[model samples]
Target: MPADLIFHHYANSPFSEKIRLIFGYKQLAWKSVIVPNILPKPDVLALTGGYRKTPVLQIGADVYCDTALICDVLEHLRPEPTLYPPHLKGVCRIFAQWADNTLFWAAMGYNFQPKGAAQVFAHAPPDAAKLFAEDRKSMMAQLVRLRPGDATSAYRSYLRRIANMVDEHDYLFGAQPCVADFAACHSIWFTQTQVPVMADILNATPSVGEWLQRMMSLGHGTMAQFDSAGAIAAAKAAEPQPPGANYLVDSAFQDDHGIPLGARVAVGGESFGPEPTEGTLIAATRTHYTLLREDDRTGAVHVHFPRLGYTLRKVEAG
Candidate 1:
């Protein structure tokens, strides 16, 4: 039987939209657990410990963080309509990483300008904007954000580059949509769907606008609502199914941090949402790391994070 795929995410999360689009592309049904858009995500923290980022993929007793790793999990689950087409595998990965990090940051910096934030919080409570600002400030403590004017200039240039990429093919890299296409689409999607006033930035690139329509048409696949309590209970009752021997393994133990398996460690993002999750290091592969952790509410679980864009360190005991 197929494993139960539970997605913990909020509707407005751009990364969540990327995964949702992937789900649509794969025609996979999944359980949706909507999380809060702000801090004090207690329920979410109970599962992730300290990795408080939105859009975490929970499978039985295994929790996968980061869209890159989650994409690999989804691909492993349903191999057809592969996200990483064999021919463009490495190129697609590199492009997707750029889109997810650099392009996404530029688009977001532009989208959250004073004018766009005003539009976003227009319907919300007066303090909603302040709260969001404080929350994001804390999450991105030391990370440098581009100025609105600079971000706007960069965003436009990036959109033009994307237009060039999709000018000939229906999607980036080929006729069929790949990881790069999905990674690039979410940032644009956020601007169009959530902040239409700012979406004028996309107008200059007509090809990109047309491609966005094609990407949007994929639609989210069948989904069922799931409550946090139910998800917690499911995790409590399930045993983690970490990658088996058949799974990809690094030839050498590739130890750069001097951390070893079975040691207590913490893994987290280097910039935004830098909260670290501490656990017993279980598996450290070439592409990702796995942590074996247990909670009273969720029982034993294995949390996974991609090696890229994350920091791993030994937890110093008091």
Candidate 2:
């Protein structure tokens, strides 16, 4: 059976935009379920247990959280348009990691300042913008956010570096687009496409603008809109599948958090978005971990999160 692919995301989400581009690049038919920009994502919470990040990919009973993991799932389903090429795999992975972490956040911090923030929230209600700001503030917690001036500087520098990369070749890695290109382009795309008033930073690097045009050409292919309600119903109707037995990364004892398997825990991503996901640790592999939990709406869905940014803590077992 061809596994069902459901994308739980909103349009304004830059990370979600990255996956949408991937879906279009691969020409994969998927059900688009628009999720909320901020918290109280009950439907997404239903599928993910508690990993309330945007762009959760639902494949059968498996719920993949984070755009990084979603990329892996998409690659598994469609290998034709490979995001990570064999020769450029290492460099692509490094560049992608840098782009997703550093570039993406800097761009967002800069793009969501007063000027760009107004452009984004122009259509949204006053309360809507306030709620979004409050929600993001809660998620950020102790993390230090860059000042608008600093953020703008960092973003401009990052854009120049990206332009330098494109100056050598058509894409970040080479002639064809790679994971790094998509990851980097999406953030820049958000500034240029979503918040054009603040897009003047791209003027210093016209090469980045030309590159973005090419990226835009790879349009988000035919996505039939699917309701979040229907997606929750689909997940509710299904049975949870066994977790993948194979380990995807190297297992090294990095942290002192000696949490055992099957222990109830809450894992929160360090920066950007710090929402905590609570569940039973089903699989603590080398790279990622799988959590099994019951949701009132969706019954059960195995949610996955990358180990890098997330901090795992033991929750009181009932």
Candidate 3:
């Protein structure tokens, strides 16, 4: 039997919500492991090394970082209600990438205005806002963020484009939801659900709002709470699953960075949450790079990251 799906994420994470909705769409039961919203993410770092991002998916001894890779894993596991439609796979993937990054940033920029930020931290501890800001600021060091006024304008324009897409079909591409739908929904979902005060921005695009309601109705599938310690123990006890011969047979070593397989390397995001994860390069496919790393708590594991929007480097010898 396949090992249980273990997800590490928090409630307010928009990316996590994307996976959760995918679970609902697939009707898959999963183990939910909630981690701290802000650092220090000791438990998460235990598995990801330094990739302190929310919503890391753990299957047996394999750890998948980045929602893009997680979505691929989920689709591979259950191909019934496909995330990538056969005919529109390329288009769906391109649209999803844009939604995950471009749309997400614009939505967040608009959502976290002074008014929305106050509403978000209203019920939290006094220092919650400050700590959250500092944590995000550290992750976003050297990256440019859109200002509220500019974000509002861009977000509105994006919404109108989305409105045009969904004006005819029920989803962005067609009658059924695809990877692009889930990716786009999460960002807008945050504004509508987490920051209702500023949600009026979505009101202008009635079509987008209606589409969001449909996506929201899917709800998160069956979920059971799983603690960090238990998750770590599970990983420690299981052996890493070997990739199928077919899995890597056709996937030749596409060396873009000149880093050979078995070399020590560090992979990380190009912009936000730039903590580098160091490990031995195991697989370098056209789309992603996989690393084999060991942790005292989790033993041997394979951490996967998408090639795009991320940087790869050789870890210098000490």
Candidate 4:
């Protein structure tokens, strides 16, 4: 039997919601391991080395970081209800990428305006907002955010564009909810779910609001609660799947980077999340980079990352 899909994410994470909605769309069974929204994510680091993104997907000993790769993995596992439709695969992925980054940041910029931020943390401890701000400040590797005014304008314009797309159909792409729908929805979902005070901005696009309801009706699929200790145990009990056809791009080494296989390297986000995962570079496929990570708790593990929006570097021995 194939290993279970063990997902590590928090309830309030916007990216995690994107993956969760994908699970609902695919109706796939998965195990949920909620990680800390802030820091001290020792369990997460054990699985990802240093990739500190929320919503890490683990299957047996293989740890997949980034929701982009997670979406591809899920689509590979469940191909019937596809995220990448054959007729519009490239366009779907491109739009999804834009939604994940540009739209998400814009939504956050507007969502965190004073009143909205206050409303979001109204129920949490007083330090919650300050700690969160500090944590995110550290995680952000570069200053790519827009000013509040620019963010509002961009978010409004993007909402109208989405409204135009959904005006004709139930989803962003077509009759079905493709990746673009989930990608676009999560940003707006954050605004609606986390900061309703700022969500008034969404009132202008009633079509988008209607589309969100249709998307939410799908619901997250069957999930069993799995704790961090249990996840660590699962990792320790399994062996990393050997490199095979599924791990290869064209069944050969695609050496765009001068560094070859077997060298120690670090793979990390190019524009964000400065933390890098250091390990023996096992595979550098056109689409991803795989590293063999040895943990005392998890033993030999394969950590995979997408090539886009990330960088690969040689890790020098000290």
- RMSD in angstroms, all models? 1.6, 2.4, 1.6, 1.3
Q: Write the per-residue lDDT of candidate 1 for residues 1-318, one digit (tens) a residue.
A: 256789999888999999999999999999999998898988788888889888999887888899998998888788889999999999999999999989999999999998888988999998999998888888899688898889989999999999999999999988999999999999999999999989988888999999999999998988999989988998898888755521223324557789988899999898888889999988887888888888888988888888998999999888
lDDT of 2 by residue, 1-318 (tens): 246688888988988889989988888888899889888887787777666778788876778778777777677667778998999988897888899988877898899988898999899887988998888887778678788889888998999888898999888888999888888988998999889999888999999999988988888867888998888888788776665521123334334478777788887787856677888887776667777888788887777787777778899857
- Give lDDT tens digits, candidate 4, residues 157-210: 999999999999989888998998999999999999888878899999999999
Instruction: Tell me each candidate's TM-score.
Output: 0.96, 0.93, 0.97, 0.97
Q: Which parts of model 1 are misplaced by more than 4 Å? A: 245-253
Decoy 4 TM-score against native: 0.97
**Which 10-residue window in model 3 sums to the lowest lDDT?**
242-251
Model 3 lDDT per residue over 1-318, tens place: 268999999999999999999999989999999999999988888888889988899887778889998888888777769999999999999999999988999999999999999999999999999999999998999579998899999999999999999999999999999999999999999999999999998888999999999998888989999999988998889877655321222256789888899999999899988889999988888877888899988898877787888899998789
RMSD (Cα, Å) of candidate 1? Answer: 1.6
Error of 4 at 235 (Å): 0.4
Clash count per candidate: 0, 0, 0, 0
Question: What pairs collide in candidate 1?
Answer: none
Task: Identify the superior model by lDDT, candidate 2 or candidate 3.
Answer: 3
Supply the TM-score for candidate 2: 0.93
All candidates' lDDT scores? 0.89, 0.81, 0.89, 0.89
Q: Give the residue spans of candidate 3 off by over 4 A.
A: 245-250
